[model samples]
Target: MISTHLRLSALSLAMLAATPFAHAQTQTPRQSGDGAYLLETVEVQSSADASRDGLSQPFAGGQVAEGGQVGILGTQAVMDTPYSFTSYTELLIEDQQAASVGEILLNDPAVRVARGFGNYQQVYIVRGLPVFSDDMTYNGLYGLLPRQYLSSSFIERVQVFRGANTFLKGAAPGGSGLGGAVNVVPKRAPNDPMTQLTVGGQTGGHGHAAADIARRTDDGRFGIRLNAARRSGDMAIEGESSALSMAHIGVDYRGDALRVSADLGYQDHRVDGGQPNITIDGGVPIPDAPDATKSIGQSWTYSDSEDLFGTLRAEYDFASNVTGWAAFGARTSDESSIFANPTVTNVNGDYTASRFDTAREDTVVTGETGVRVRFDTGGIDHTVSLSGSVYDLESKNAYAFGAPAFSGNIYSPAPVALAPNTVPGGNLSDPGRTIHTYFQSVALADQLKMLDERLLVTLGVRYQRLKDYNYDYNTGNRDTNFSYDEDALTPTVGILYKLTPTVSMYANYIEGLQKGARAGNTAANVGQTLDPYETKQSELGVKYDGGRLGGSVAVYRSRKPVAGQDANNIFKIVDHQKNTGLELMAYGQITPTMTVLGGISFLDADVDGDKAIGAPETQANVNLEYRVPQWQDVTFDGRVIYTSSQYADAGNQQKVDAWTRLDLGARYLVPLANGTLLTLRGRVENVTGEDYWASSGGYPNAGYLTVGAPRTLLLSATFDF
Candidate 1:
């Protein structure tokens, strides 16, 4: 086991790392006659915007908020930010009975959730590009959350920032996220003591039990919270079963000039006899989806994953306009799995499968430290920030594969005996070191407010150093006796102009850096490393706030360079993708008893000279909730989503049909004696039992279809005391 002391060393090194900071004092208060001052001092508190702390304040309908974490800028108001983003509060997570982060993102118009290549890892597609779960950040740090599954209960808020953010958040350690970024804010104890116990069940007799307990000192300066959940039993799929266990503890300290917080979490999840994606071959026509609940996977197929992670963060305010903060986080993950996902060879879903066993271990350490200073030069106000961060990850992996040795059909199939693993990549029981990634960056930014605070301009830059090392599976020696090292300077510029007291216009231009891709075992230049590259984005948008009603309209363009082989079978970064899109969204209370949240998005994308896969030309989502006037505690909600036809291949030869799904939900709250409250919630997805292919490919640059989920019921009751 790696020594815990080493983690602390990394944190210390990063905290002490120096980053350049710049400022110019142009404004100076002048003395006036009669001892009167010409300009009064406007102090900017170091505590940051209170709204930036968490998604505590609802914009209107309680579905989403007006602000969220914006990389190193900490939290900024949505109206004040130049980027398009949304933060889903804990209330929404509970009200919807969302099982995981993937489920909660269904309400987003610009986002789609799908399964990983051959495993159960949740993958997110934002703005026509893929953001792997591994790229997601916990708080503001990277490489901490579970790679495959992240439970909804373990997080307090889901913050989705659309557009390339490498300049703001630093390049993702996973080398992905060219489209956007996702961050989960851990729960914190509220001012009042809160304790909630919940009982839930879903279709297929799946049972769940969870608890949330929180307590704060009388002075509100010290607080702690504990949460735990367990889910098990058969799922909606026939003969399929799954189990998930999770626990989290949060502690915080709020002092006069200092704030400290710590969070610890553990998750263990497993799935057995669940259907996997089907890969098509030879430009075969896509086949109709069968019973969504039917499972053609072998009974022996199973996956197991467990992760333990924690983060400690604190901030000290030297003065009202100066604050310093440092944070450290780490994660240890382990996994073992046996998979037999099949490949479809015919138009009828007929396929061949083989056994594949794998094991993996990962250790990650991440840290960040920064100071924020606000001052005025001449008549202009500036908030200057200097920060440094480091993300270090070491991964050990092993795999054993058996060539396609069995045949089955997607419409009607039977499981066969498991084939012997003939090709052992290494010891699946205990894998050796496979890869290590060390990424470090220093950033500086200044938010300048001019025009009497009506116009805001943000200028920032990040200097990043990326290094990757690969080792042989059996022997720990370097794969090719060499390591990969590269660096880049990413810059960002954003502007927000207030057209009116309640309306604003914003635009931003940014760049994102990603590590280079490597040649696979089958490539002619296998083991060769290509140079890293960057993605670019430009956006313009306008927002309006009408008290209880709010909405925004945005247009953006982005481009990312991937990998492709040349005519000579040499791999390079010549392949690239460009996407342009428009988004219109609204969320707020339209009336005293009614609230709505929805959006429509359209995109045009191309990879090289062909259409991009997975990015539908159009998508839309709408959700409305109503509270009965006669019954104050009763509420009803419904949602509908539409996705346009999407190609199953980059060539655009095969396509998945356009599909739409509907969901309905209801909830009630009952006040009891002595500060006790009871809440009941229920939801049904795909109310009409629609069956279709939902997405093609979740892993980067791949085409695999995952069938849409069948009609599913989720019901839960919670008692808060």
Candidate 2:
């Protein structure tokens, strides 16, 4: 471990030394007429804007925002906050032609995308921990978006918060996000009236179209926006096809002291013969990855999902120094799926597969209210906030397994007869209540600024309660003995100090909370519920904003308790998994015609003196965009992603090889005689067509391999009037 740490440190130092650092032109802070400091500010049309707290302006390169939300504390400038975060803007999304939230997050070196166990839901790994898609919040409220997939047409900003954030935001309802959190901001009408249409196609006969329209009243107090899109056809992988439809409407009212906004969305998505993750059987050697374009899934398998959701938010200003806000959201979703993921039993790629079918229904309602007050005591400035939130989720589910397993070869798979479900649980058509979860929390925070606003300190705490219940899948009888009701207090402390006009240093200590697991029937303490687990993190970092070029370097350490049964067969918290890492990020223009965005992360993760499964030692990403001075309307961009080798199992005997991928894109804009604008874009992913395993192990203690996407081409055209 010592030698590995030293090696990583050396690599980080070398990269930093090779990077070009530009000196920022010093400038004095603007001041009001009353001689009070006036920090940088962005004009927000209304409190119902993208972030609800006011959308942060884009940075120098127009790819990332200058700042983003700090949970209940509201928005703060990147240089002023004592935490690490990045907000991707709509401009970047459009330029990249990203179709999903996971695609947009690829630019972050600290994040890696994976698939959920036995499903196609997108999962994110941040700092060696998994954050489920359902755990993501929409407009500060949870469980309002589609559980398995989300469309990008309605998204205006994607905010990523790094490190433990239970104190900033309440504990995620899905029991994930121990390392980080992601929040999506919905789109709203802009100041100008607009109509846009887009059409696109990809390499596998897939086609798509979308429409966006927005308008505002004469007084600019009432606004409405509508977005709709559809896509259908085969994907890059052979034998796999998908169809998706989505519609969303956003309405808002901006008043003198009261602001109100509402959004409604609907989505229907289906996939046939989707590729599945490969699981390696114990004692079997990890086989080489198969051809990227090959599909081992049975053609009879399919997954279908439909969802309807909405949110209402209002903000009122009681006074100039006091503000209050409330938000409510609800969602109803249904999913049905038949899966045939195979388990490799030998080095030659021979595998055993069985048919599994499931149906699920979910109903969720969540809300939050908060008040913020600003005041001053002597020479110290203070901002205090008090907030409360509640979330409830009821899920009904049923499943069945086929009679016998089938055998196949990974190298060459052949279609088999559709298997019949024999072993059943509950009712497949109607299902039954299997799980219910309720979460409630209240938090308080205060921020103090001293030394002429050069030094800032923040302290916060949250009291959270989690109630969970489970029922027998077949009988639908409540499992009273296994139910859990628990609570915990999570707290945070952060400090930031400005060393110069454009340089700031910050440190933070925070905790993340999650519901504990109940002992299994085989354990000596069966049916016993353990206390909630709190994951703790400590971090220190320095940031530099050069106006044109900016960057940051941070070091952090975190520990999370691991639970298991001891030799006596009593289940308990036995050990703690520790992760220490260094992250370096750089973004903004590198020259007059060149812009760069990307970063690298080095991590050392272990549990019980052994390497943690699926934790990589190094990950890096670099994206560069350049405009041709000769052809002023044309721009080109490219990106490279790299990940180091990782262990796939607890014993550290099975290792998934490291991999790298490259993507390139270009776009052109044309001005027409009718005063309309037309833009065309083209992108190529996996330019080298290298076949490899993209990720290993998304679920806890499980080792599954996700095949990398094949080389593919994407093209799109947009018209604006």
Winning candidate number (TM-score):
2
**Candidate 2 regions with alpha-carbon error over 4 angstroms:** 1-47, 50-53
Q: Candidate 1: global Cα-lDDT? A: 0.82
C-alpha lDDT of candidate 2 relative to the true structure: 0.85
- lDDT by residue (589-640, candidate 2, tens digit) is 9996788999999989889988887789999999999978776467899999
What's model 2's TM-score?
A: 0.93
Superposition-based RMSD of candidate 1 using all C-alpha atoms, in angstroms: 10.8
Candidate 1: residue pairs that collide? 26-378, 27-377, 27-378
Provide the overall lDDT of each model, using Cα atoms, as 2-decimal numbers.
0.82, 0.85
Residue 145 alpha-carbon offset, candidate 2, angstroms: 1.2
lDDT of 1 at 706: 86
User: Clash totals for all models, in order?
Assistant: 3, 0
After the best TM-score superposition of candidate 2, give how far the Cα of residue 688 lies from its true spot, in angstroms: 0.4
Q: For all the candidates, what are their Cα RMSDs to the real structure?
A: 10.8, 8.9
